[model samples]
Target: MRMVTKKQVPPLLLALGASVLALVFLLAFQGWIAHGADIFLSLAQAGLSWCF
Candidate 1:
């Protein structure tokens, strides 16, 4: 006879993790993250231009 063990995650912890992931996805879909990235990229380009 073979014995099998299954591991289960707590529902509260799973729900919290899922909520955080959903929030990040929502922000990304709404372009909030992209807006910050665009600002950072523009600043980097300006700094490099000054160095050149």
Candidate 2:
């Protein structure tokens, strides 16, 4: 009788999948990320009383 073996995911493949998911998330939120950074910079400038 032949035994059925479960296939395991390779570590490299797992890492690659995680990286791809991260990239997808970053691309999807690109606009929001830019907006957040802009807001943060504006607040920092205000705190420093920079009028430029």
- By TM-score, who's the top model here? 2
User: With candidate 1 superimposed using the best TM-score fit, by how many Å does residue 5's alpha carbon deviate from the native?
Assistant: 1.9
> lDDT of all predictions, in order shown?
0.80, 0.82
For model 2, the superposed segments whose C-alpha errors exceed 4 Å read: 33-52
- Residue runs of model 1 more than 4 Å from their true location after superposition: 32-52
Looking at model 1, residue 12 earns an lDDT score of 98
Number of backbone collisions per candidate:
0, 0
**What TM-score would each prediction reach against the true structure?**
0.49, 0.55
Candidate 2 positional error at 37, Å:
14
Clashes in model 2: which pairs? none
lDDT of 1 at 43: 72
- Residue 38 of model 1: what lDDT? 77
Error of 1 at 34 (Å): 7.9
Global CA lDDT computed for model 2: 0.82
